[model samples]
Target: MVKEGLLDILKGNFLVSDEASKNWRFLLFASVLAALMIASSHQADKKVHHIADLTQQVKTLKSTQVKHKREIQQLLLESRLKEELAPIGLGVPEQPPAKIQIVSQP
Candidate 1:
């Protein structure tokens, strides 16, 4: 009997047998689970790729920020300021600034 059952399974006859109706619900549930697992796997892959792309963008933005910071620091130097202002005839004062004292009459 066991050999016959195994033979029937191997020959795919069990799928058409009367007992097959009893397993339809379980088969449908398993198929749904398999499809959900595939969809979840694809969603996970998309998130991973998105994270990688964002990481690359962050690296690029960081490098650009560093470049701009360096340029700003260079421009803030007194020598660079003097060079930039030379064309406009602006220069450091040669004499000290004077402060005037006012006397209040009582």
Candidate 2:
């Protein structure tokens, strides 16, 4: 049965026959749709993997940003600066700073 069907397909008998021609067209359409579905699935998988990679990179960048932010916050602390400056004998001034005004000659 299968061999006869293959022989009929090879001899183009299906194209000339009314019932077989409809089946042939339907099979061809189905095959094309299957191919497109496979291609679309592959493309979707590629995009999913790309999005996963980007998500991981975003997480890494966020962690790095957080670490830098924490470091900056620690560095900006007055107690931390005071401790760091103790060796140099630098301390906050007790007096308010004076403003200096310069007069330009005309």
Candidate 3:
């Protein structure tokens, strides 16, 4: 199998080992290393995906913040305009716009 060949290539120490348990030791070591590599790669992919999703969320929040700021500015402008028109009675209503009062002379 491909796994066995790669495992043999990685276990260079096994070729020089004189002990009968050398094969078991080398295979176990190689298997552990390969597992670690696989786990690290999977973790790295998850981290990258999380970062990308966070970036998109940040962009969306930034856009929403800008829109809220614009709305606040517009409301402020409207309030100031209303204040300026208050003396001449152009916008706000102490009375209706079409209503007028006349005085009677004796």
Candidate 4:
């Protein structure tokens, strides 16, 4: 009888009409598998949402950076132009840029 029961379990033939109280092992196994599938699906969906949100934020920051960089460059050009026109007293000369000279010692 015990060998037959063991073989039944090994064969995994837990039919729904089984009125046997000892048939809960198959139910528990199925329940755990179902729960695992649900949790993994939810986790994957969350990761996808997070990635999309991060991508949008990165795009926004990149556009903001580009705008600020363009404004800074325009300001620098205007200042240099004013300096060049300062000889006729339209503006004061701007300070010179820092220099790096590579000197060779023989």
Candidate 5:
């Protein structure tokens, strides 16, 4: 009996035999599992690519921020401020500022 079953499988007879109906549910289940596995793999690949893109964007933003910070530092320098204000007729005071004191009556 076992030899006949093996021969039936090798001859592709089992696929057309009446017993093949019993295997249809299991075959459908396996097919669905394979489809889900393929979909999961594709989703993981997309997430990896998205993360790489986000990482590159973060690096670009960081470099741009550093450049802007350097420009702001240069603009904040006293020499640079004086040079910019000089063109507008503004000059530094030569004498020190004075303060007045008032006495309160008791």
Candidate 6:
């Protein structure tokens, strides 16, 4: 009888047997785990793409920052400032600057 039952199970006839009813909960749990694994994999892929996009944005912003900083440094040079001021008739004085000390009344 036991050999006949084992043969029945091996022949894909276990679902019609009493053991299938007893293992319904295990089957349900396995299905849920499989669904969760699929969801987790999709979420991981989304995060990877998001990180790549952010990394590219950072690189673009860094290059822009470097370019702006170079432009600002070039504009702030003494020769550049003098040239710009000359157009406004504001050239630096040739005479040495004098300092005046104030004396307070006693």
Pick the lDDT winner.
2
**lDDT against true structure, model 1:** 0.93
> 14-72 in candidate 2: lDDT tens per residue?
77786876878898999999999999999999999999999999999999999999999
Tens-place lDDT digits, model 4, residues 1-106: 9998788767766544366445677678889999999999999999999999999999999999999999888768977778767787886537877799999999
How many Å off is the CA of 66 in candidate 1? 0.5
lDDT of each: 0.93, 0.95, 0.85, 0.83, 0.91, 0.91
Off by over 4 Å in 3: 1-20, 78-106
lDDT of 2: 0.95
TM-score of each: 0.84, 0.64, 0.58, 0.58, 0.81, 0.79
lDDT of 6 by residue, 1-106 (tens): 9998789868968666577875677778889999999999999999999999999999999999999999999999999999999988997799989999999999
lDDT of 5: 0.91
Model 4 TM-score (2 dp): 0.58
RMSD of 1: 2.3
**Candidate 1 wrong stretches, greater than 4 Å:** 1-3, 99-106
Error of 5 at 31 (Å): 0.8
lDDT score at residue 54, model 1, on the 0-100 scale: 100
* Deviation from truth (RMSD, Å), model 4: 9.4
> Count of backbone clashes for each model?
0, 0, 0, 0, 0, 0
lDDT per residue for candidate 3 within 1-106, as digits (tens), equals 9888688669865566576387778778999999999999999999999999999999999999999999888767978889877798788667667866898998
Every model: Cα RMSD to truth: 2.3, 6.1, 11.3, 9.4, 2.6, 3.0
TM match of model 2 to true structure: 0.64
Residue 87, model 6: Cα distance from true site in angstroms: 1.6
Task: List the candidates ranked by lDDT, beginning with the highest.
Answer: 2, 1, 5, 6, 3, 4
lDDT over C-alpha atoms for residue 35 of model 2:
100
- Candidate 5 stretches with Cα past 4 Å from truth are 1-11, 100-105
